[model samples]
Target: MLMGLLWASAAAAEAPSMPGHPEGPMAISSRSMTVKNLDHRIIFDRDVVVKKGDMDLQADRVEVILTAPPNEAAGHALSALPGAGGAMLAEDNVERIEANGRVKVVQGGKTATADQAVYHNADETIVLTGRPETWEDGYRIQGSRITILLKEQRSVVEESRVVIYPDEGSASGGP
Candidate 1:
């Protein structure tokens, strides 16, 4: 179920890998899972947790929106078709993911928290809203909204307040 979410980035990564690489496998658990094949969506409700590589995501509810038609089966099934990385449809299978209610993402040294988060596969972008805040190393930023474009390698925070801790050497006035 989870493998179909980011298989394209892993399969089509000839140059280099993207953030949250689906290199291995993803583990997801929730109070319950609802598979709506007719709607081409999967919903995980209540205390949902998702982990992939060094990234961990937690939310009260998560919805994986698939691009497949109504006839399409569970998204993971598309991963087996032949094509680029066993069919790029695997990529289309998961068009986007929406997380709501206390959404938090932790990857390596970085962490982000918000009330809602949406990840768009085609654009490789993640948008966080509802008092979003992000932190890494000694830097912290809180904003009304945060847009992270992984493909473009940039982040934009609106109405942001940032705090950057000075380096020890710099703080000590070292040459």
Candidate 2:
């Protein structure tokens, strides 16, 4: 069944390090939540919000797919390393995330809005679709699809439209 595959994929997925994100815990709130430990997936619906560090994502629904922890042998080896137990545990989980219906993400001074957004933790890439738009630093970009590389601080937009606003003094056109 499709459900089974989704669950299996979650366990096998890998999470990449996210830049500009603190190592603190992630908090999520929603009108309703469904957690399936066996499937390694969590679904939140209705006014869902996920917050971690300085970033917040809001949407009508959100799905989180978690990765499996390292094997016992690997865990033992990792435990031998200095300061590796807890931090490594966190880094090895949380494979992918999906937000749907009026998804909005805000981080620092940047904001992105879309009907749906899928974040691949393994690659630190976020793909936004359905009227995707992003705004930051007096510039706005909208496109059919937008891909953001979190660690690189770069965005690629397909079939895009861009607008840049001039500063007040520059817009005066006196000199």
Each candidate's clash count? 0, 0
C-alpha lDDT of residue 156 in model 2 = 65
Model 2 poorest ten-residue lDDT run: 1-10
Q: What's the lDDT of the predicted structure labeled candidate 1?
A: 0.60
Q: Tens digit of lDDT per residue, candidate 2, span 24-89?
A: 556677777665666766677887777666677789988777674323323421122232111112
- Model 1, residue 138: C-alpha shift (Å): 1.2
For candidate 2, list the clashing residue pairs, or say none.
none
lDDT of each: 0.60, 0.58
Positional deviation of 66 in candidate 2, in angstroms? 1.4
Q: What is the TM-score of each candidate against the true structure?
A: 0.72, 0.69
- Global lDDT of model 2: 0.58
lDDT of 1 by residue, 1-175 (tens): 2211111111111213225455545555777776677888777788888766667788999887788742464535333222221121244557888899998777655567789988888877777898887655555667787776666545666777765566522212111
